[model samples]
Target: MTSLTLALDAMGGDHGPLVTVPAALQALKSNPSLKIILIGNQADIDPLISHADSTVLNRIERIHTTEIVTMGDRPVHALRTRKNSSMRLALEQVRDGKAAACISAGNTGALMAMSKVLLKTLPGIDRPALVSCLPTVSGKPVYLLDLGANVACDSETLFQFAVMGSVLCEAINKNPTPKVALLNVGIEEIKGNDQVQQAGQILQHTEQLNYIGFVEGDEIYTGNVDVIVCDGFVGNITLKTSEGIAKLLVHQLKRGLNSGFFVRFLSKLISPRIQAVLSKMNPDHYNGASLIGLRGIVVKSHGNADEAAYLQAINLAATEAKRRLPEMINDRLESILLDINS
Candidate 1:
């Protein structure tokens, strides 16, 4: 049996153990053999777990961490000075080989900071990218890269992103021939910047990728494309915008249904369909993003993730850990980089 031990920064998120403790418990119910090293103040975390089941308590272990790396602080400084912080401690567990992977629903900057400084990147990977999957309007999920990691990416970096994102799709999403596209201001190669234009040309020539040229923002929710590549700044904005739009749609749907007798009558007729639509749109479905290209597996969840949200994140972590995602990436990437250089 594979020992799937994961270190979680229980103190790193907005809700802290309030949500973390329950999430951990929920994950355990599904993954019984999973070993967890909760990094947080015992006093803070203990209270949350006190009334819980004995069996759940037995499987989970604790590594008390007092200091915390806040979201607003400078990321690099927080990592350095907050030596005993939960995020740092949790990351160290993976770096030291004590754990297979690390999961955090905390500061994105700090998580990326610790990843770059401690885990390091694989050879030929210029930088590690944050990659997430979002449900498209077409009902399929698309892989979006650099979702706020590397804001300024070059042509070669984009090529690397395609490779990593495709491999990820194959592993988790079962996307055999994952179509790759560059997110442009317009759907044409000529519509993008010099870097993007250059990347478009390069992707067209790359044999490894199923490159499909350029795509626009609206096309993302349509699921016409599989991999949407962009710099972190663009990807981040696009993701947040999509989230906001989804929320707005849900908000309007709720209001429209609750107004009056006619509205309520219409709502009853459309309730099932609307619920099905909203269920698919729920952020929990795509709750985890892999910090790809690092020496080890590191997944980041939303800062305000709830129990079910973290459950999705942990499911991702467990799958990757069992498959030994880090080792697999290293193996597959080594020969590719070598071939490119040769």
Candidate 2:
């Protein structure tokens, strides 16, 4: 693999340097070709990596910044006032081609706002969508998009999202013709809002995409579809709700197993298998959400992510950087738009 550098907002998340520093160290160890630029206060981050060997230390660089975009900070406020903040510096690395991608566990709104302003959206894409991978029942990864990036989307925006998601699925999942679906209230044609129906019609007519019909909320993890497109309002709720349900199921199973001595004895034998299944459904594995269709790759890690979870986010940025996902999406959209115009 070729060497690539990633810019990290080291002080962006809840745990700040404590989580990001350790995660960067782990990522560097796992991927020898990877270099990370930690953007944050030098004093806070130096202590964490000070003891590392020269080989590791050589690959890591730090950019000092004293400002932070807090979780409560508004997007406009951060953009206008926090130009020198770690988050902004991290994105600037990508904007200036100093880094292949930027990953942050910072304020979602601020990150999105700064990214769009600094990196800009790709041509043919009106807005960038927040897309993430989710483990499916078939053990494949399903891509879901618009996860709180744009709460309201028209049909044309939804079509662009499908195009971006489809390209992403093909690039990351290596599916030649990924099955794309629109998330709707029901499978029937008469069931959804006008935007969904119109978008479905547009997708169905597009020969370039393998656009399937509507899918309900329950089908997200069915693995029948490779990309599921929805507005941010619904997508965010579905993602959070699915994560909550997975955690609840694991908790309930453990509680039930411990309720009786006989069950507990059987749990000793069955616990490993159950845990293996639960681990696949763990949200940490899916912590990074890509803000797709931007000129530069930007991944938003869960604000509360721990070291391991944040590492997953870094890994995600690495993969997308290697794949040149934004270029692929732009090419695909251009081809599709040209075909439609013709």
Candidate 3:
């Protein structure tokens, strides 16, 4: 197998090299064919490398950058001022074909802005959407798009999201004809605003989309749909809300289990099963969100992600790079456009 190189913004996340470097090393352990280009201040990154096994060290390289894009930095500001920052350098690696993909846990706004400018959008794509995998009840994951890329979208944009999202699911999840849905207030025909309803009309008419009608927010976890499309504002809110609720439930369940001696004993008896379920629901396992529609693959890790979560993001980038996801998306997009024109 050919080796895959990923460019990582070592200074992007809250913990910078402290978290990203360790994660990159851990990811390298699992994926033998993977190599990483770590972009950040050498003073900080060199020490982390010094601690890694020498064999693992051979697969890693470092690029030095003095500037850092903080979580509080404005997207526009980062674009103009931080041209040589770790984030921009990492993206440049992908754009220049030195790396197959780029991963950052920096400011979402800045990453989106920089990636769009550097990588550009695929032909026939108006704007890139933030896509991510979410675990569903059927044990199959649902791909959600426009997680926060475009805050407001038109009917046409929603249609594009569905197409891009479907292609993504097919490429990564190996679902050839992933069921697609428009997230809305209800399942009724007249449920959503003009954009959503109009988008639904287009989807229903489009060929080979497998477009299901409107789906409620509650249906997101039901595994009833393989792909859920929505404007970024709604999608972002929905993702964050779901994550919060999942954490809360886990916390409450632990409290209940520790309430008394008998309860604790029973918890131990069922701990294995409970842990399996909890592991499936853990957000860390799904930390990478793809900025799809761009010419190259760029994954956004959570700003506050730990080593484990960051490792998941790196693995995601490696998987997509190996799959050549950007090319797959472009090809599928052309087909979808041709169908629309026909």
The model with the greatest TM-score is 2
| Number of clashes recorded per candidate | 1, 0, 0
Ranking by TM-score: 2, 3, 1
| lDDT tens digits by residue: candidate 2, 97-139 | 9999999999999999999999999998999999999888888
Q: lDDT tens digits, residues 1-342, model 1?
A: 555788999987778898888888888767778888899999999988888788888879999978888889788788779888899999999999998899999889989998889899987788999999888778778999989998889888887787788777777777777899988989865798887888888777666668898988888878888888998989999988888988998898798789899989988898999898787678776799999988888999988778888878888988888877666667766766666567
**Per-residue accuracy of model 3 over 151-221 as CA lDDT, tens digit each:** 99999999989999998898888898999999999999989899999999999998878998999999999
Q: Where does the lowest 10-residue lDDT sum fall in candidate 3?
A: 277-286
lDDT for model 2, please: 0.94
- Which residue runs of candidate 3 sit more than 4 Å off their true CA positions? 264-276
Query: For model 2, what is the error of residue 184's alpha carbon versus the real structure, in angstroms, after optimal superposition?
Result: 0.8
C-alpha RMSD for every candidate: 2.0, 1.4, 1.8
**Candidate 2 error regions (>4 Å):** none
Error of 3 at 260 (Å): 4.3
